[model samples]
Target: MKKLVLTGAAGRLGSYLREPLTKMCDELVSTDRVDDIGTLYPGESYVQADLSSLDAMLEVIKGADMVVHFGAIGDEAPWDDILQSNIIGAYNVWEAAYRCGVKRVVYASSVHAVGMHLKTDTIGLDAPHRPDTYYGLAKCFCEDLASLYWDKRGVESVCMRIFSCAQATNARSIGTWLSYDDLIHLVERSIDSPVVGFTVVYGISNNDRAVVDNSKAGHLGYRPKDNAEVFAKAVFADTPPLDNKDLANLCIGGPFATVELGNSGVAALGVVDDRKET
Candidate 1:
């Protein structure tokens, strides 16, 4: 690709993706609301932009072959905050992509979009939306928005409903983990795939205890290599017995399914800040 744009460049996941994305395209434009994202990769440039502004999004996404949109609040928040950063932000991204004539959008969706479902039931790409929080509702909105753009404006999109992208620190992560290596692979597949009009795929690793199916997205060729089972012994040993009645323990969304309407769910997961430095 001649040019690729990545949003949320200052985030932990974005930090890891920056260097690798620079290698995929001649020019990788990374954007975030922050002033700076430390150092830049060899073929990369940084742009400070807010996702809520359509003009700013257009400027960052213009002249791009594809957009890897990972920008958002990343957690449950007040309705107003979610409205601006997630719901409206998603509209801006897709609208800007449509206007810019970008070929595809690789969105970072989340499992919380269907978090209210039972963990025991192995769901697939066709599962209905059962958002667990305002944050999750944002993901559901984006997935539908991606679909709308594809059908109405010919703007392709791949919405990856990512599970736990952090370390397998708890029992829930044992079945929901998506390692860093696997994440890069998924993004690569979404970008390189030749003919994805609008697709949804579960962002999970090759674990023995995975709770979601990705057979529908086989065309993307996303084959995760890492497994959370490796951390099973330690996590199980350190953790207490599970409560079958607890929504957090029984639901696919884990802490998110049980969190208050606008409260943060990630705080209970104990994800460490391990952003890769440039």
Candidate 2:
């Protein structure tokens, strides 16, 4: 690719992506609303922009070949916050991609998009949307937006429904954990895939207890290199006894599965960083 644009550059995932993204293209333009995001790599540059503003997004995306859009209120928040950051922000990303002649958008969708589904049921990429919270609902909307962009506007997209891209700390993470290396690899595959009109794949490693089926997206060749099973013994040893009645334990989205529509499951569970700092 000639140029690649990444939103949410100040974010944790964004920091991990900076070097790899820069190596993938001639120029990597990273942006976020924050004033700065620490130091930068040789081939990477930063921009300050809001996701809700189409004009700002368009300007940042100008002359880019593809966009990796991860900018949004990443946690479950009040309806107003979710509406502006996730909903409107997603719209701005897609619409701006279309207007700027960008080829594809790689979104950081979440498992919350279908969290209400029972963990016992092994669902595929085509599972119906059953968002656990407003944050999840926003992901659902973006998936639909990706579909619309493909069906009507000819732009392509790949929505990676990330399970849990963090350190293994509990029983749930044994099945849902997506290692940092795997996360970078997933993003790379999403961008480099030969043809992905509008695909959705679980952003998970080869975990033994993983619940979601990613076979439908097999055509994209997203072969995960890490496995959460390696950490199972240590994780289970440290994990507290499971509370069967807890929505978090029973729901597929884990913490999100049990959270209220406007609550913050991410915060409640404590910080799980992918190491955004330089």
Best by lDDT: 1
The worst-scoring run of ten residues by lDDT in candidate 1 lies at 165-174
List model 2 lDDT by residue over 1-278, tens digit each. Answer: 88999998888877889899999999999999999888889888899999989899989999999999988988899999999999999999999999999999999999999998877788888789999999999999999999999999999999999988878777888888888899999999999998999999999998888888998898888889887888888978888898888878877888888776788888766656757667
Q: Kindly provide the TM-score of model 1 when superposed on the true structure, using C-alpha atoms.
A: 0.99
lDDT (0 to 1) per candidate:
0.94, 0.89
Per-residue C-alpha lDDT of model 1 across residues 1-278, encoded as one tens digit per residue: 99999999999999989998999999999999998899788999999999999999999999999999999899999999999999999999999999999999999999999999998889998999999999999999999999999999999999999999987889999999999999999999999889999999999999999998889899999999999999999999999898999999989999999989999999999999998987
Off by over 4 Å in 2: none
Q: CA RMSD for every model?
A: 0.6, 1.2
Number of the predicted model whose TM-score against the real structure is largest: 1
